[model samples]
Target: MTEIAPIAKPDRNRPEPLWHQAEQALRGLIADGTWTDGMQIPNEERLSTMLGVSRITIRHALRNIEDSGLLRREHGRGTFVRSSTVIAGVRGLTSFTQEMAGLGLIVGSRILERDEQAASAEVASALEIRQGEPVVRLRRLRMGNDAPIGVQTAYMPLARVPGFLALEPSASLYQTLSAHFGIAPREAREVYRVGTVAAEDAALLGIETGSPAFVVERITSDAIGPFEFVHSIMRGDRYEIRSRLHI
Candidate 1:
């Protein structure tokens, strides 16, 4: 494979911070496909030498990009470009598989764990179920283009769903619930907050621990009433959160 050249240093006389200059240069490289997704980038020494900045400055620029979800730094390994992941707003109800497919991304998931459990007080409130009611907890590591992008942990009242896990795990959970479980989602509400990736999440998503991420909370209703809730953490770089507003 041909080694990608380091970005040229910016003019030092300019007033911009050295790290910001490096950020611009590196972003250009990634956008132009000089450095593709999952491709390892040059180390701090090389970046410092090529960008004519201190190692600390290079680190700062990389950190900024990583926080922005354009790059990921692996501990004891080098930084790499992040794969693009789509974010579909909950303007209305939608299926996860359909949402990703609509965006033309091949979506898959690693079913980290799945089982039935009693609803906690919070889960009970979200699902509108009695506390200790049986709820199916489906934990999955969501992926796009075969790259880990996010972690989705969903809870659905078992009484409202039947034979959910019997269907393919790769299929849309919402669809399965609607088709066989007769749990068609009619409405949904979502909330988001900036969060840090814990060690478990970081390992599952193939990013550094303490990386910036988005914590998403969602509750969806069937034609009759609400029965599902999801707690999801998404990689900031690979995935974006987008919405539309009407005037």
Candidate 2:
């Protein structure tokens, strides 16, 4: 079989950062189907030569790609391309940030809505709070490696989490709740369903209107009572629900 030339070649003379260029080239290989899933890529030394960069540069590029969940590295075995689709396990009451971090993907959030509102009937019912009770509504566009992954809207009773709205926009909800408010979920129930996202959610998730998506509804309760209710819309193309079954 003939050797396949890399589709993207890093330009040494270009003013752009060399490691970033190398990363783009490597990512291009995977995106274009030249380097397939589970295929072990060249060694750092060989990649350095092919990309016209130093071993350190190649290493940095590989690390970035790996952090995006597109590659996995073994010490004895070489680095290999992971599947482009991200596997999000639903086995626990895990936060979005924690889940992405577990998969080696960088998590980011852009707060789309953060304000106190009287609980609607649906929200009241989910959180087991009285209707018209004040609650904190936090809606965010969740991203993994700067790519849109999901849109999440969470509601928490103001009595349980006072001053939560003052936190930073990108702060992890669970961490802040546990650290500042002394709240933790003792038990949680999550419902997952396949549905199409509306135009607003689709735009936030960077997908087309009415795209296939996963609608996840969750109610997290502490020892005292239910404290949080969350609804999330996850992109179907890039996300998969995974769990390890026990006998």
Candidate 3:
């Protein structure tokens, strides 16, 4: 175990709260490599003594860091440092490839399962198509720098995209859709919620079962109509969804 030095005392004259100042100091340690990834951080008691603050303040600072995906807390074990989360913008209908590329990450995908199937009630509802309609189902493991980040399963009405099954496996389904059927996504709506990773998805993502994850349901439409429905399980520790609001 590496010894982490104590944080500097926050300026009492500043307007910043003690917890906020502690959080910034901790983050600086992470940024400067004082705390490396997967290294267990000092406990609240030790941190409080080092920073000359209360344990409550230390807890608040750790909570903020854990929420930001830079640290993960285990039930019995102490918090551990982790890589910074990958920020995904929620402004447009960008493909996974485009999103990863924007962050300077190498995007990759492994096709887990691909087959033509009848649309279920949920898929039909999302795609605005009749039940039992032919649909192409694709299950893929989305990767960043060859590390698994998410598991995505997409459904597309086969009636509209003929020969889609024959196309080569691709990291960007949007590009495949455009190249094969001249179908470009014009808009997309997504619903996000926090959830635990299931056994199957956890295995694929190389995380423990019941780990925190983000469940995203997306419905995308081209100029013609809704064409794709996607269900994604994104690793909460490795990804963060960001959105900007305009007044």
Clashes of each: 1, 0, 0
Give TM-scores for every candidate, taking all chains together and pairing residue i with residue i. Answer: 0.66, 0.68, 0.68
Winning candidate number (lDDT): 3
lDDT of 1 by residue, 1-247 (tens): 2387756787789999888888889878876779787788889998888888899998889887765556777898878877456655543467667766665456888889989999999999998889999999999988876778789999998888766667677557876776777677778888889999999999999999999999989998867788889999999877776555689
Q: Residue 86 of model 2: what lDDT? A: 61
- Name the runs in model 1 displaced over 4 angstroms: 1-35, 38-83, 166-168, 243-247
| Tens digit per residue, CA lDDT, model 2, 1-247 | 1245954667767899999999888887776668776788888887877777899999998988876668877888778877444676645667888877766566888989899999999999999989999999999988876778888899999999888878765458888888988998799888889999899898787778999999989999998999999999988976777565799
For residues 1-247, write the lDDT of model 3, one tens digit per residue: 5786657987878999999999999988877779876889888998989888999999999987775567877889878887435676654669989877765456888999999999999999999999999999999998875678999999999988898888888768888888889998899998889999999999999999999999999999989899999999999978886566899
In order, candidate lDDTs are 0.81, 0.82, 0.85
**Which is better, 1 or 2, measured by lDDT?**
2
Error of 2 at 159 (Å): 0.7
In model 1, state the lDDT of residue 46: 82
Against the true structure, what is every candidate's RMSD? 9.5, 9.2, 6.9
Ranking by lDDT: 3, 2, 1
**Residue pairs clashing, model 3:** none
